[model samples]
Target: MGHRSVADLMTPTAITVRRATTFKEVARLLKEFDITAVPVIDEAGHPVGVVSEADLLRPRPTGGAATAEQLMTSPAVTARLEWSVVRAARVMQRHGVKRLPVVDTDGRVAGVLSRSDLIQLFLRPDHAIREEILEDVLTRTLTLAPSAITVDVEDGLVTLSGTVPRPELLPVVKRLCHGVDGVVTVDSRLTCDSADRT
Candidate 1:
């Protein structure tokens, strides 16, 4: 099965701020784009930090017009283009961040992956999900006949029926089906033809 990578969902063109950019400018960009945060980049287009709405909201010690370098969270949390959506989400959760500045192989700022980007995976079409379950899981992985399993998908939920060669393969079917990008849950009513113990 082809799982979606961060590159598939991230905004290819990201709005960024420079280290010396004024606080007002960062706030304006955020509001103009209707985004909660923007990545701070260097002259080479390498991300140095991220300036967020919360960063802008926090009162500064100078109580004057500050710059993005002063307001941004440093040692920027980032993601790579090839990272799996699941891996990107775990990184974001581990860092307690809503967005990640996406970098290229050479480490230049390419785009930005947000919580919304990750959520889009679950929005894939139901037909695609069904195809993956039937082709990738049952047919390819388990080498089961096309007629051996019946896969039904409604919204993001998957229901697997029919019979498998062994009882163990039933759970494997449910698991691999659930692992598909758009799947929300698995309702397996599969039976086993083999007289194996449960």
Candidate 2:
């Protein structure tokens, strides 16, 4: 299966805040929006940082007087719309963040992506995985007829069996199938024509 992009799962029209937004308002927004954090945008609507619940709850010198600009984690860790969900997960893990501000080409806040969103899309059904391997891996990638190979998927595991035109390409097919999302394992049961088996 093709990699799902962040844009496919992100929540567009995310609630955002300005740098001058007060601490109390930030807290209120988090509660009202049911979000853990919000991007602090500049006048041009570009995110400069994010203010999460932890940042707001920690003791501060300014206390009640503090604003989002003073408390936010600066130079925000962001994700692009085109990034694969796998790559986005790595970024979130690297930063130890529960959510990321999705940014457009101009660096403006396009949406918000949460851990749940990635997890929901990561686990695909066995039938969908089978179709991709048969349609993409076999027909398009290997340039073989659909009838040339038989693909079976069960519980995220794929089994491939048939007489391949090029025995040398079996390894390539296995690798591609393994790369597909939700493919837990691959079982190769392929052989080649006797004359080509040298």
List TM-scores for all candidates, in order: 0.80, 0.80
lDDT of 1 by residue, 97-166 (tens): 9999999998988999999878878898999999888888888888999797788999999988888887
Residue pair clashes in candidate 2:
none
Clashes of each: 0, 0
lDDT tens digits, residues 1-198, model 2?
A: 556788989999558999999999999999998888899999999999999999999999999889999989998899999998889999999999888999999989999999998777647898899888988888888788879788998888899888777768888888888878877789999887567546
RMSD of each: 3.4, 3.0
Off by over 4 Å in 1: 125-128, 135-143, 165-179, 185-198
**Which segments of candidate 2 are over 4 A away from where they belong?**
139-163, 184-198
Task: Provide the overall lDDT of each model, using Cα atoms, as 2-decimal numbers.
Answer: 0.88, 0.88
Number of clashes found in candidate 1:
0
